[model samples]
Target: MKKLFLGFCLLVGIATKAQTVADQPFLQDSADKFSLKEGEGNVNLLQVGSDRNKAIKVLSSQGLMLLYEKNLRQDVQYRPLLDMNIVALTEYQGQFVYLTEKAVLSNAWAGKLYINHGIEAPKAMGMGPDFLTLVAGEGNFAIFKNNQEVWRSSIESLNPISVQYDPNSGQFLLLTAEGLYQVDSVLKTAKKVFDGSDLTAFSLFEDTIVLGTTNGIQLLDRKTFTLNKLDQKLPWTEITSVNNIRGNLWFGSTKGAFKLREDGKYDYYASKRWLVDDHVADIAEGPDGSVLVLTQKGMSKIDFEPMTLAQKAEYFQEIQRLRHIRYGFTSDLAMRTPGDLSTGYFHDTDNDGLWTSMYLAGELFRYAVTKSEDAKQNAYEAFEAMERLTALPDLKGFPARSFERDGYEVGLHANGFSEEWRQQWEKENGRIWQLSDDELWRWKSTTSSDESCGHFFVYALFAELAPDKEWRDRAIHQIKIEMDHIMDNDWYLMDWNGKPTAWGKWNPEYVNSFPINVGDRRLNSTLILSFLQTAYHFTKDKKYKKGAEKLIKKYGYDENANRPATVIGFVEGEDLSNKWNHSDDEMYFLTIPGFVNYSFTEEQKAAHFNAAKSHWEVERSEKNPLWNYLFALSGGENIDSEESAWWLREFPMDLIDWKIDNDHRKDLTKIAPNFRSQTYTEVLPGDERTLHLHNGAYRNNGGSDGKREYAPYIYLLPYWAGRYVEAISAPQAE
Candidate 1:
């Protein structure tokens, strides 16, 4: 009995060891904590801080008028004797307020008092105990505090910009177009801090006062009044404003938003969208070091829990592991169970589309490449099941629509628009169009039929990885069909129902009309490469290379000639001239470098690689990581020292940052305190349509192009670029 017990214990110990080995690679786990709440108005301060209980808010209601107070457990916490509402809130010893209309200054703890004003109209305002100042456009000025008039002094160029206070040192500072001034609390006087320093704003923290100008931020030791230049280089950033949260300070710059770490190092942050025009108005730290933010349209949050050194090491190992994982599949296209048939949690029932198949295929490939055998097996089964489903006779033409029982195609359903503009269209005449809820499928047909090229690429990728002839043949046939039907002689992929020629002729309800025929060349090129690469693996044909060459030539290699010659620069906000749809190009660029199987001269390969580089160079920035990820992938495969160094320098893990809670704006630089990228022009200010790449921009007017937006394509960009880590951030190979 003792011998038998010892043997069983040994078996259990081995099993335990195996399980530990499996779990070791899986790291970087995160769970969703909170759903965002909606708010309105010129929310000046949205404090989502370390103390989660303190959900205090302050916002402007009537331009200059303000409303503020923290939500209390029982009753409203009122400011004593302050009848008129507060316009702005700041901290000196505690929370202080700047009231509009009555010219009253008050504190949350201290009682309120009216300040004497010398001028009839106050254009710019700032405060200091026993002192208050107002500027009226030109050199006109007023100074008062503590309900008493004080001596006022002004020069020709003192255009007051911003004011801030340092509590620990008991000092008040004001910024103007000419220079910075130190306000004496006792004497009620203003003195210049430095000469020839035109100021924009000042950032105030616990013991830090940072002065911002066209040059850069100037840090001052509040206690000693010692000056230290934070950034000496002019145009290092075009700082619009500065914010304080917890022990850190943040800068909203023209290039992007950055967070100053406790150690005084800088890191960028965005809400994971495009905020080219909008400024990161304010930040509120939340539970577990998470931050709540307010931008122009709504609020957004980000949780940053510091990773330990061990975690960092694990992350690097996973990165190396991604290169080693090999992928394969069976040659037989036949299957016992349909790949689309699954009892999984995320199953789709809509039979018409290949959304579910593409999703599963992408997920499986991602997992498989990361060395997850279980996920690999699952992915294989998914593809096999899809093959079986495709074999169904009635569903053959890769029909645009599919029905479970009747096996019939459902025509497009439309909801009539309230406006007369869209009502003229036949598709938009009457009923509301609702897509199927449950559908397990893959894209196949290249005709006017609604199909996903994603399906073909997914199958082709599997075939290439595994060396399957049958899969390779199917991919080739599909590629030919795609080329003949949608791809024009110029290498541009036609949008809307396989129409290879002019816009709106083939399909009326297609996307953008202008160069709409060009579409996302990245996607077209990626899919073509996938087919060419896989076909080469099986047949070793130079014809595939010839075909790819033709496409490349027509499209100008990187599809630059096809895509609009513009890239949105979000220095202040998203520059609309640059926000062209390029997800397709992004995907193509990512997979182009992996075309090692194809027969090509070194010159040809170099040309293709350079084309991909052009796309990356133009689009790459802090806000957009899809481009960065693709750039890194291409760099990794090519093994070019310069490219690798470039990626490491610019697109580092800690370096990629996004703004939070910006409404869908194309340009982020133009909009202030509304991290969303918005477009602004001298003619029509704050036009989101011209600026952003969303539903707001592309509309279904009576024009050739119907109602559609490019934003959805933006989200799918990561898949084609092979930037899988950014998608799931999975540390494990699986």
Candidate 2:
């Protein structure tokens, strides 16, 4: 039986109020999970019309497809129409209705809707209850009901564009290039509804006729026959299709798709996440609360399934173990064929230790919160992987970035840099791929501060929380080795070449080399000081504490650490400071736990927590749960969790790295482009934007062209970390 250490419990109370919550039993709100099913190919989706019965009528170049879908199951039956010359299709009385060039036909209707079995080669048609109406020539309108041509009228003023049926008023609405028109088939008359120019699409919602044009959207009230232009901004304005699926207005535009929310803000769904192509041709209601979208290529269905965060974590864990693990380390999946998971292979990347460290940290947090045996086992396995990183390097506490078979990646050039360039960079510092003492394997070298930061943070968590004595001891020993090496090397993580690896330098000269506006100065200061404090806290080593004091008192490292995130933007002529480093944000938030919770003095703890809060002030708009919960370690009451939970709920269930775009969206309040890439006044919801884990910019518009897939360890880290700190409760079943 394993138990949380009492010393760690006492340490929590002594430092701050981070883990000081009683169990929350009645926390019941949950979020939905998304599942995207794509029907993708080269064929264009010409039009999407409703099916009166149980299936959908999708007219495309390939043929007419009756798409039947329910929950997780879908079936599509195609009719090539090789034997029949068909121009258009619709459903009439539970049977297929074909509008061929010669005649109007259906399997069930006894006679043609048009009198004398004649049909007009019209611009558009609208079919509804008791009537079939078509706009012929400029303004000739004809309606047929009960197998009779009820009306044939000519309105000289209207220029015809498109026709749609309004179910509420039992009337047909028509759009025009110059104005809007309405037809009362029962009354057998056509009249001008409203005056508008360049009208492209229209959909009926209650009394309002929502019209779309090249400029924007407008609403026409059926009773008043007066049009009121919709004042809301849309994602795109070159409208192609407008649909009201069960009262919600869905617009398909030349750029992408969007839905008008009740609050007047549009929920934009663009990129590969929602469509096969951004040139959406049609939008319609789908089966079982799903949204069906038709693009130039094909159709896609987006389903929202009700689930809690806890359930999501379990599902993520299962997939992470099944497809993401390589040699006990969390790894990347490089697709041999782009966009195909079957063609994926577990790729040994340069940050295997860093990524696995994060995964291990999350598992440890899960074990701390629930004491789950499986969580413990997961932590142990990942810990072993990271342990191998330290031992394989053969440099005391130094850890290799990753490892693979000897011949696996000897000549691989990654990060889009050329082989020649990489060889020169490696030669400048040291060898990057070091062959192991054993002939069968090789380990990576020149590890960065980010990798070391992840290792230190997770190792401290394991040493303090793991109940297995051997694991805890090994964790502490690694910390001592690393901390001692830094002290012995004059505050530098030295490589075998007797020089500091480019980014592993933390000496006073290196740390102070850049101007105060640069980030590396503040970041390196915080990292080494926190490393010492955590080492001292864990092993009660006086030398570690003395080393930390020497840096703080003499070199002013504490003051530098205290302002790590502030003044870290847009330093002139400095390449490192040209943009915000999201990787630095990740490292800072992850390492803040050890810095605040394991400080040597009460004064140090408070100072560290205040620094963290300062950093979070800038990061709050990002809505990252890990940053929020880690900052909550100060047990501060000022933190707001609404945005954090919003991010969690909005995270996409599909983790594929599909190419995404948001730059064209009109709904977003865009700002002048800057170094931080905070492109908009407000961030788009998670599913609508890029899924680069913690690197999500507030309004990042585009990234990733379907060549890779992330493991989603990003979600797990924050979720379990929140649970461990009681910022999040257990899953609440409804």
Candidate 3:
């Protein structure tokens, strides 16, 4: 008995650890944390001390200067050393050696400049602690020792491009058109370590020597000197410069600069993130491990710091709070124009309730996982806003797109429109109504089928999870009214004009008319099933279940639900169904968890689960976190958990819709655009594509002029759902 009890305890311990792992945070937000100290002109050279407190020295067109921070502040302080056109600054044999366009000066920082005129200003130079090597013209080379010439030689066959001193071997490695050559101070002999042509630059490391060649970066073994090409994996082939700082390899190319992490993956920084220009001229390291990138335009310092998962969650939460206060309540705007979050000038999309419903679902999951009062309150507020949308219109359960004050203009269009323009817009936007005989209120009409999906989705969630009995009853009441209106109108959402809205028709006549392979047929059939199931789950009404069964038996709706997965790929001649509708994808996936969770029978659950799995298989290449989270919730696959985490991490923290232009980027791997999907091998989703509702993220072009700030719910839904399903672990406490 004691042994059995011990075994049970062991199992309990293992289960607890597993749950903790899932609860631990999986992503964090990271930005360039280093502040750049701009220079007057192009930076020629950068040097720093080994100590953390030491200041950095920079040589530029403005002259030599000391860059340091007085205290922990955002700005940097500079101290001038000499206001001269200095090209290079280096420490040689315990003295500061300064190179100019005309002459070489020593001890310039000590107010006593000793000039060396034996060798004219060389095109390329290399400095060691005790010796200096200069390359003049193409291959004419000379060595200097303490302001005196030691040796001079010329290898006219090899065109010398750059020079570097190896501290480990105490010798100069010269990069020439032939290969890398090691030369001694006497210049009597030169030994070729590697046979390589077109070497632009080179850096020596403990185990390998990295060469910047025309093809790409080449890694050569220190002893054997064999070449290993990295061009296939690199974003660009033309390697211009290379630097090794504390094991992190920084490569500069004609396209952009990238740092190779210890894990062997490359982190690319371009497009105004860490560079002022794509052409990287040189790279240096500061005392505190910051990277100094010198481009053709100027210099930029980037502090590469890894963010923790807890920080990411916190950032999203804060953004969610701000967006909710600004735009999530009342009539939720579909999208905000770039940099206009405060004034609420946004696009009043047709699916306001649908967007808010997804956000409400996220809050519901948050409440379920954390039991935080704030989560419950937020869910209640969004529910109230959605509930009011149904009450604004008099057509029984017909919910409006959104609502506004009676005096407010129909669309509330942007400024600078003429009075004549408002008259024509009134027909489209002006649908005012009075709910009561005495009171006046207006709401936008012409509701669609997608709105019904969102309505049922949130109503089902509220019915199942609302902490208050009154709120649960309200949810059920709302569901009954909406379902009754749809059924009584012959499975169509009739608008205020007594005509079915543009997309609200789901009757057999309309649904069955589409070809068997069409998306509308599958989508309408699947939406009706989810709607009926949700109504039955909340009301326990036999009529709702009977309605669903009739569709499956009569119109082959069950077969139609299975057909959506096959049509996920592009089909020739069927442009409407072939072009992936991301909005419909959003509506489809959001309905799955509720439909499956509240399913009435084992058979029903099986059908819904299989349909969801099939769709997920098609969407796996897109790597959408929300879809992956929903699939995992339905017990499809958890392998996407890590991928879901990656999506959340890749989401930009800057929610503004800034114009992103990738056309000029040479590092991007462009593929042929197709109807199936657009993809790039080099750029991530946020960088290459616009923010959209569906898997359109893989469609790589768009965001040229501006981007729209998506509602925070878009991110919150997947995050909280991942946590609720144990696909993402809670972050460990800091």
Among the numbered candidates, top TM-score falls to 2
Q: What is the lDDT of candidate 3?
A: 0.64
Residue pairs with backbone overlap in model 3: 22-729, 23-729, 23-730, 24-729, 24-730, 25-730, 25-731, 27-309, 93-129
Order by lDDT, highest first: 2, 3, 1
Q: Per-residue lDDT for 1-734 in model 3, tens only?
A: 11111122233221111112233433332233222345433334333212243445555445554544421121123223344445565544434556665556654356444445344445556777644545433546777666577777776565666678877667788887679888887546677788877778778766888888777778887666787655546656677778787777878877777777566656665544445566776676654456766666555666544554446656666766665442345233334342445654443445668877877888887777789898898888888878877786778898887665556424543222466754554576553233432346566666777788888877877776678899989988999999889999999998777778768888989988777766777778888888887788768899999998898898888778766476655546765566666667777776776555555676877787787777778677677878886665555555466666767776766554444445544446767766545556533645334555543556443443233455667677877777766667766543
Each candidate structure's TM-score, on Cα atoms with residue i matched to residue i, is 0.44, 0.89, 0.78
Q: What is the lDDT of residue 46 in candidate 2?
A: 65
Give the runs in model 2 whose Cα sits over 4 Å from its true position. 1-6, 12-44, 49-54, 67-117, 130-139, 155-161, 230-232, 410-420
Which candidate wins on lDDT?
Answer: 2
Tens-digit lDDT track of model 1 for 166-235: 5554656666756667766557566777554655666677666777666677777666557755674321
lDDT of 2 by residue, 620-660 (tens): 87778878876765444445565666677677766777777
For residue 270, give model 1's deviation from the true position in Å: 8.8
* Residue 560 in candidate 1, Cα distance off native in Å: 19
